[model samples]
Target: MTILSYADSALSLLPPVVAIMMAIVTRRVLLSLGMGILLGAVLINDFSVIASGQYLGEQVAGLFWDDGAVNAWNMYLLGFLVLLGMITSLITVSGAASAFADWARNYIKCKRDAKLLTMFLGCVIFIDDYFNSLVVGSVARPLTDRYYVSRSKLAYILDSTAAPICVISPVSSWGAYIIALIGGILTAHGFTDSGHLSVFIQMIPMNFYAIFALLLLLCVIFWDLNVGPMRQHELNAQKGNLYDEAKGLPPGANSDLPEAKNGKILGLFLPIIVLVLATFYFMVSSGGDVLAADGKPFSILGAFEHTDVASSLFFGALVGFIATLALVLIQGLDKLYLTKGLVAGARSMLPAIYILLFAWTIAGVIGQLETGKYMASLASGNIPFALLPAVLFVLAGLTAFSTGTSWGTFGIMLPIAADMAMGTHTNMMLPMLAAVLAGAVFGDHCSPISDTTILSSTGANCHHIDHVITQLPYALIVAGISLGGYIVLGFTESLMAGLATCSILFVISILVLKFKSTQAIS
Candidate 1:
């Protein structure tokens, strides 16, 4: 039951590695995650069965009530998920989703248009990755469904866009956190000429993974680059099989309920609009208080830096739920039907919530084991200055992949990356830091236990394994391209050269995919 550091040894990597391998082989996400948690608890407890059991129990309990009080952030996020499910269900049952689809059908003539719209929404909702993941999917689902775009593809679009866009946007939650982290790193290194905001802006161009991931997504969409398992999923969709029903229904979908025929488009848009506005309002409001408490002047950046995202999302979802319920009631739907919507909504979210809880518990166990620290340790004692950016990118990606957290990787690797660059390769400091961001996101994109990835599947209403399996090829391809870019930048120390390399590689990749598709058709 006592926590111990395994950062000095290779033991820290076992749990995540076991979990990831099992998830891939068995395709039972919860069971795989549970096994990993069990293994991690045993390791932390030094192989004591009784102690491990107690530690596991405590970790589970601590998720809801930690440090003598309710865990506001975790509880609020769960609340938001439940409320979102209810809202989605209510909107559908009231026939709004159908009406929206019917209206959208008139304008969206082809599958390509449907996918383009999905990708566009994914980019536009850049306030937060979690918000972007869930909201974009809900808005785009009906249209994509009508045009037979696979849920796996929808999930891909959501996952790819969410974190990449957030990391690069200064006003986003991810950007705010990264900027603050960079500020502390700069201060520690005694660099005062440039501030965090300016540094982040400068690094944006150097963030190869984020930039290329987005561009690759566009290529996949524009060229219908259905590679690997994605090709099968897309093919199935063309035949009216949106997902493998045998894998089980998606956690966010409610198929048993009959929707009303008189649904209006207003039913869908009203709640979603309110949700976005309310969440943004609460994010700034909550962030403002923290800024004031810190004796800092109010600014958008300050607000985002101090915002309570979990609470803001919960309150916004609550308001959105009320709007959805009101709209349903105004339609004069039967009370019993309304009750069904509530139950169905809550029931549908249970699987996703369970996966989230398991993922969180395992992440905590990995944290206690100091897995990230161990990974960071490996990045030390590097050789050449020119290769530092590439090395850091790979290390950061490994850390995030193992820990199932991009933010945790950023926290651990950013300071070290900064110190390494400042001490040895001063001119490459920005590139080093940018490489960390890029790698963290790349790892997060591939990690099975990443919350954003889980939520992307939930939002797109795809089987979790299906989403993971189908998206892997695309993620790995982008990661490879990113790694190459970092190496070019590291050797040349020129951002333009690295970007040009990425651009050329990306174009070639698109053409190759196009040729492959043609071959497959022939």
Candidate 2:
């Protein structure tokens, strides 16, 4: 029995705290996470670096095999991400990406249309947030560039729809994960009768942040609701500056993908369609069916609740990659040379993979240390039950924003949220659970260190920090509205009523801001 391995000690917070502080201070995410992992290992090994060194070595070895489900999930995600990159690279090489953009350009007569197209593409690719951001950016970046739409705005649009849509959509990787989390938690708590799928579906209506964020994004696109740093970015973009000329970004791919002299839009569109269909098949097949209260197959929701999304995502990406390669090969345009895009794609994704590896390692350490449980205990006392949903929302957002991961945040907070609900018997479980999801998405949306944020920058060919700076204010506006909505829901307990009230507030606020910004522009 290790002394503190499972203890809910405050010291458990040290690792993530160290990682966050160092990431912000040095702006070196990789080095910061490594330092945090080492620091955490030392503490866990009773302050002996040599012992911790051995432990680290063991963990490195075990990452691929120590636990079956954990290893499978990790491998699946890595496979999906790398394969997706390869697909992107393949499309770019085949001129399919360029052709698609050029083909779409006829529809984009103005900046508003360009932004809306980007937003539309983002919403349509809700299979995975990672896929959505990267693909939409690549496909729409050229179109947006033609209209002088700020790279920041493109990144914003790419990011805004990616996670928000996935969070709300019932058929996404995120949906499967959320249901699994709820199912697992309720099962653990002896509430075996509870249907995690049903609960998640119900919580959808209460996901204040996602609904508002999506609505806000559409308004921002159509109404030209530029504010804060975004306004200046848009103004500069109109003057032919895509990014701030005063600052130099770190060396990265400038995204000068060649426009294919001979390419087909079908080559690009068909693969994504295949990926979606394949993922859905894998999801339903993996997620076994159950009989409903009406004694019939519970349909897609039943499949979602049981689906193995990690595996589904991996296969989906793999299918898309293979389909893209075949499509290009059939065209005989690039010949054997185009195969190189596979390696190039995976290579391009290395930085993101490294970040994910380190971030996940620390999250694992945090789990071992029971840091989440510590947080729950620390924040539990003296709060009125009616206020818990809002508090949990705020806490979740802060945790996710600092750590830069909604999935990891879900791991840390979902259990706590479930336990608190059972312990308090506060019937606010639905909204509270919803709050955690919304907050996690909100925080991830806002964080500079987030993987999606980095990918958005890479996809849009914008500086990473620039994407973060321009997007944070928008995230905050929605987050603030979410907080207020949660507070109201805690008392009213009517999901539709709460959503109706918040939607009106969001539209009114956006209209007022839209008027002010447009006047300022005129």
Global lDDT scores for all candidate models: 0.91, 0.76
Candidate 1 lDDT at 244 equals 90
- In the range 299-330, model 2's lDDT, one tens digit per residue, is 67667766677787788778878898888889
Off by over 4 Å in 1: none
As a TM-score, model 2 comes out at 0.84
Candidate 1 lDDT score at position 40: 97
> Model 2 Cα displacement at 144 (Å)?
2.8
**Model 1: how far residue 348 lies from native, Å:** 0.8
lDDT of 1: 0.91
